[model samples]
Target: MEPALRRAYRRESEETRRADLIAATQELVAEGGPEAATVRAIAARAGVTAGLIRHYFHTKDELTRAAYLSLMDGMTAKGSDALEGVGAAPEERLAAFVSASLRPPVLDVGAVVLWAGYMHKVRTDPELKTVHEAAYLAYRDMLQSLIAALPRSASDAQLRAEAIACNGLIDGLWVEGSILSHAFAPGEIVTIGLRSVGAILGVDLIAHSAMLPDPGKILP
Candidate 1:
C-alpha cells in the first residue's frame, strides 16, 4: 500500500479502537457497578486485549474517570433534549427538565449502582469533583431561572432560595428514584417528589396529583 493509504488505514484503526474502548466502558458501567467495570471486564466486553486498555488508560482510576465523564455527558445531552421546546409555562418547563434529568437511557439497577459509585468518586476526586459540581450547578441555575420567571409573588432573593431548595429536593429524589426497587413505575417517584417539593416551596402541586398514575400492583 502507498504511504498515504497506510497512514489513513492506521488512523481509521485507531478511531475504531478508541470507539470500542468507550463503548465497552459504557456497557460495563450500564450493566454492572464500577467494580464490574474493571479494565479486565471492559477489555472483555470490547473483545480487545487488556494490553489495549492499558495502552489507552494507564490505570483503572483513569479509565473510570473517563467513563464517569462520558456518563455525565450522555445524561446532560438527554436532559437538554427533553427540555427543548417544552416551555409553555414555567411550571411545565421545570417539570420537563426534572423528568428529563432523572430519566435515563438505562434504568436498570446495575446502572443506578454504577452512577452511585461514580458519584461517590466525584465527591472525593479533586480532578472529577469540579465536573460533578458544575453539572449540579447547571441544573440549579436552570431551575432558578425558571422560578425567577414566575410571578412576583415573592422577592428575588426569596425565589432564589426556594429554587435552591427545590434543586436539593430534586437531587435527593433522583437518587431515591434511581435506586429504589421497581415496585413503583417511572413517574411515580416523580409524582411523590413533586408533591413533597411543592409543599416545601409553597407551590400548588396538588392539582397535578390527578395526573399521576397508580402505583401498579407488585408483580411476582
Candidate 2:
C-alpha cells in the first residue's frame, strides 16, 4: 500500500480499537456500575490486552471519563438528529426532539444505568463534574434555542427559565420511563411530555406533533 493509504488504515484501526475499549467500558459500567469497569475487565470485554488500554488512555479514570462523555454525546445526538427533515416550524422541531428523547435508544435502561453509574464519580472528580455540567448546559441550551424560536415573545430570562423547567420535566420523564417502563402505556410518556411542555411554553405542541415523520414509530 502507498504510505498515505497505510497511514490512514493505521489511524482508522487505532480509532476502532479505542472505540471498542470505550464500548466495553460502557457496557461493564451499565451492567454493574462504574466499579465493574476495571482496566482488566475492559480489556477482557474488548478482547484486547490491558496494555492496549494504556496505549489509548493514560489511566482507568481517563477511560471511564471518555465513556461517560460518549454516552452523553450519543444521547444529545439522538435528540438533535430527530430534528432533521422535521420542517422549519419551531413547534414541530421541538416536539419531534422531545419524542425522540423519550423513546429508545435514548430512553433505554442501559443508557440510564451508564448515566447513574457515572454520577458518583461526577460528584467527587472535578473533571467529571465539569463534563457533567457541560453536557447539561449544552442540552439546556439547545432546548432554549428551540423555545426562543417560538412565535411567542419572551425575554432572555424567561426563555432560560422555561428551558430549565422543560429540561427538568423531560429528565424526570426519561428516568421514570427507563426504570418503570411497564408503568406507562405506549405513547403515554411522549404525549404527556408534549402536553406538559406545551403548557410551559403556552403553545400547543400536540398540534404540531403530527408533523413528525412517523408519530407511532417511536412511542414506547
Candidate 3:
C-alpha cells in the first residue's frame, strides 16, 4: 500500500479494535461488573491477544479509564439535545438540563450496568475521581449558564451554591436510580427528585413536568 493508504488502513484498524474492546468491556461489566472487564477477558472477547490491549493502553488503569470515558462521553454527547428546538427561555433550558441529567437511558442494560460500575470505581480511584469531577463540572456549567439567563437576579456566590447543591442532589439520585433497583420505584425516584430539586433551586419543575421522563420507560 502507498504511505497514505497505509495510514488510512492503520487508522481504520485501530478504530475497529477500539470499538471491539469497548464492546467487550460493556459485556463484561454488565455480566460481571467492573472486575470482570480484565485484559484477558476483554482480549478473549475481542479475539485479540492481551498484548493488543497493552499496545493501546499502557496500564490496566489506563484501559479502565478509557473504557469509562468512552462510555460517559458517549452519554454526555446527548446534552446538545437538551436545548434543541426549545425556546431559549432560561427556565425551559434549565428544566431540559435537569431532565436530561436525571434520566438514564434504560434501553440498554449493558450501558446502564457498565455506567454504574464505572461510577462506583470513580469513588475509589484518584484519577477517576478527577475525571468524574470534571464531567460533573461540565454538566453543572450548562445548568449555571441556563440559570444566568434567568430574569431573577442573584449574587454569584448564591448561584454557585445553589448549582452545587442541585448537582449533588441529582448525582445522588442518579446512583440510587441506576444501582438500587429494588429499593424504589423508578417513578417515585423521579417524582421525589424533581420535587426536591425544584424546591432547592426555587424552580417549579412540576409546572414543566412534560420534560420529565415517565418512570415506566426508565426501567430496563
RMSD, every candidate, angstroms: 7.9, 6.6, 7.4
List, residue by residue over 72-163, the lDDT tens digit for candidate 2. 88898899999988899999999998898898888888788789999979878999998888889989999999999999889999999999
lDDT of 3 by residue, 83-103 (tens): 676665666666666666666
TM-score of each: 0.68, 0.92, 0.74
| Count: clashes, candidate 2 | 0
Residue 54 alpha-carbon offset, candidate 3, angstroms: 3.1
TM-score of 1: 0.68
Ranking the candidates on lDDT from highest down gives 2, 3, 1
Residue 43 shift from truth in candidate 3, angstroms:
1.0
Model 3: CA > 4 A from native: 1-13, 106-116, 119-124, 180-188, 211-220
- Lowest summed-lDDT stretch of 10 residues in model 2? 1-10
Clash count per candidate: 0, 0, 0
